[model samples]
Target: MKQGIQAFISYTYTKNDVWLITMKDMMQWVKNPIENSHLTKGYWICQFNDKIKCSEQTSNSTTKKVTFAAIINVDQIWIWQTAFLVVLYIVIYRYDKYMQEKKKK
Candidate 1:
């Protein structure tokens, strides 16, 4: 909605020996005007292999509708993170104000 860049980082460890970390930049590219080019398209960033390589599709891209399950899964993480940071900031601000008041008195 806002005219800016956003970075999204997420990790999913379904197996004991493997970890999948996904990072996406939420910015529309001039290359893909039809669809959101940043969508994952149900693919992992990497796999357990000897030579790990990541690829990007710069052409012939189609609009991928986000699934409800995916929305719920990712939104929960951001919601909790944002709430915690907001609360932390409020607490710190209040403490600083109280300290200043005590010094003034």
Candidate 2:
């Protein structure tokens, strides 16, 4: 019975220790988008060790770090894209009209 119970507990409980580091924190490490290939339209999961294993005594000390575990949904992408297109069209239209007026002058 004890062995069966232990198996049941193990099956029922699973732990996934994933840490989420915001975009702001990531910017510190990677300044340019061209440099880092994983910073494109996604939610990233970063995992780091709780404590330093070695006595490096440096400002940067971590065991592990993971990034870009998930990407933004298609619906979100469509919405943002639609908004951007609308704004871009408005700007272009206004600029064109301004240019036409200047040409007349």
lDDT string, candidate 2, 7-102, tens digits:
000011124444444434344324433343332221222221321111112233342232222233343545434443443344335445555665
Residue pairs clashing, model 2: none
User: In candidate 1, which residue pairs clash?
Assistant: none
Q: Which ten residues in a row have the lowest lDDT in candidate 2?
A: 4-13
lDDT of 1 by residue, 1-105 (tens): 322212232323223232222222222322232253233333323221222233332233442322111112242555534543443344335445555665699
Instruction: List candidate 1 stretches off by more than 4 Å.
Output: 1-75
Q: Considering every candidate listed, which one attains the maximal lDDT? A: 1
